[model samples]
Target: MYPINTISKGGLALVLAAAALGVPLAAAEPDDGELWAGAESRIQRHRMADAVVVVRDALGRPVEGAEVRIEQKTHAFLFGCNIFLWGRLPDAGMERAYRERFAALLNYATLPFYWGSYERRRGEPRHEETERVARWCQQQGIVTKGHPLAWNNADPPWLPDDLDEIRRLQMERIEDCVRRFTGLIDRWDVVNEVTHFDRPQFVTIRAPKHSAMWERVGQIEFARQCFRHARAAGPHATLIINDYRTDAACERVIEQLVDENGRRLYDVIGIQSHMHGGVWSNAKIWEVCQRFARFGVPLHFTETTILSGQQGRGRPRSTPWRSTPEGEARQAREVVRFYTMLFSHPAVEAITWWDLSDYRAWKGAPAGLVREDMSPKPAYQRLMDLVRGKWWTKLSLQTDQQGQGRLRGFLGDYAVTVTAPGKAPVAKDFSLARRQTNRWQIVLP
Candidate 1:
């Protein structure tokens, strides 16, 4: 999609998660019928009970005899499989591939940054390959976005000391990439974990020159800088200022996004909630989503982890931990809860898990929904329930003569049973609505 992006066999293969060499999915069948049906049922019966999608002519008058297509704004869940940070995970190539597959199931792919590994080799940037995967995701009807453009861990060692130079370089990187991949992806996490920059190791490996990020530029100012420049690049992308603390720091960032002077700098408010032994409980996520809603911007739970183990990518390389059966089950249950919450939250628009399978998880976090063998983990089922089980279910819809069908459904796939009055009920399939319009070409028999 962009000149800067390069696609390779590495990202196309599941080999990174050991997903390649053979199988595609786990043991469960891929009959998307059930999931789509259930998800649609919720929309038709639960959400749109009082709402109506009336077909109207160009004159804004109802056309009864003329076939009608009811286009209603229905609530549906948006899901993602995470692309982990580099060095924390060894394969940059596979990062793109896994994200491509993630696009296949969910609405979009979420990529985290490992600025160390990204710029580790100097002049050569590691983003192109990932950018290639993002392009591929677009081809596959997947929406893609990065985790952070500016974060504590995103700068390399050779950064310039001059604020002008740093700003120029950072903006250059964001602009170049954004302009390159503008059409492929529309959203980005402009920064990450923005308020907590006190970590020793993160501070230790900083570039020799511009090591003082917060000191030189306030977090909000830096965030605004990122947003403005990235916006200039894509011109059509949604820039986000993201952070984490399990506290009120995120609120401050929200204030900046809504500030009279600084408000134009942001499009979405991103949050990081790694459910490390915890779950994104439906009620809790609904509450967390409220903060962003106060500012009237959409929300994204950007970096999420529901681990079945005790270790992490940021681990000190000495922690002792392992995955347990109970832990795996809990992880699965938590995942279901997480999706339920995001789907239910009025303002929460997207939810991205760190990885699909545990094979290449950052530092071996047992947070993958699938195992290395591509076998279904309990969490996989939890997610599959949303994708193919609930959201992607196939169901029947009735269409009028104009090739338009109306049905009670969620925001996904549907198989409409079109009967020509006395003709057989010929079922035609079409994917429902998502970030963009969902349309299908039907051939009548």
Candidate 2:
């Protein structure tokens, strides 16, 4: 466990209040010197808000209905995991199983756009296959986002070694993706891992080809340019500058992008919490959110990974990782705890697990929600319980004399059913989008 360097001042007070109400808050002091603090305070009591919907007759008059049922088909919270390997599955059955697990629990998905893989040969991109998957996700009512439009590591193999050409090509790549996917997959990671450009890992030691590009154009400018290009290509897209860094330096990069009028360069802040080192302490997680919340932009846990396996030897990035029952149980608990913290935080809009299955997990670490055999691990079951069970909304009620049905629920897409005495049942579809009243006036013929 990492030491808790920062703590939210209000957390203790909130915890005390919850304790006074007889709510049990679990706080564990892990052997790794990390304190999982304020678990109970993080559990939000008011995730569902009041939504008033009125059933009306065709003539715009309120009509009493015998039965009213509201079923949430998807979440607006953006529970997502990467589907990078979904198209690569050799076995059709395995692919179906993977898609089933994904569609069952997730409403948002991250598709791979690593430049090298997306366009292995110059001038030829596998847009047909990519578009095919995007359409499939749309059919399932799932929103899709391209993993990265521009990255230091997303270098195509066939590209020339010239630095200027690389820079030009990078911008072109961003333009191509945004133009091609446009509305189908508008949200994008316009630039990834920019903070590490000047770090030793990138500049001096084991420098990737992107380091030269970074050195030439300057790190921050390159990122800004990427966002500009992506925005130009997909004017309505949500562009984000995603980084693995969560410290003050990362915040400064965001701060610098703001102008005198306090306008932000990116629409969303993408923070990666790949906790292969260990699950972040509740204090650290909360603190990070508090710091980034100052930016006044929605935060997305863009590439999250919590290992269900033993710590690897030597450096944090290790291979051939193995999973154990004990590790799986620990992983499950942390998943619930951390997710609760993120969901409760007012600034967080999305949280996406880096990879979906352990078989192809980065560096072979057991960081997947499911096992290689496609069986869900304890972590998967626990996540499902939270997303589809505890946090889900399902209701059956009747309209009052005014033909108004009062109800509250988590925000998202919903399926509505209306029935009247001696009349055929009517089915309708509605969405409880962000803001507004979420109130609807459904008419019966």
After superposing candidate 2 on the true structure, give the runs of residues whose Cα lies further than 4 Å from its correct spot: 1-46, 58-61, 199-208, 259-262, 312-320
Q: Count the backbone clashes (under 3 Å) in each candidate.
A: 14, 0
lDDT of the candidates, in the order given? 0.57, 0.78
Per-residue lDDT of model 2, residues 280-383, tens digit only: 87667766765566555678999998888885422344445678899899999989988987886656889999788887778778888998877899999999
Give me candidate 2's TM-score against the actual structure: 0.87
**Candidate 2 positional error at 419, Å:** 0.7
Q: What is the TM-score of each candidate against the true structure?
A: 0.71, 0.87
lDDT of 1 at 348: 64
**True-vs-predicted CA distance for residue 196, candidate 1, Å:** 2.2
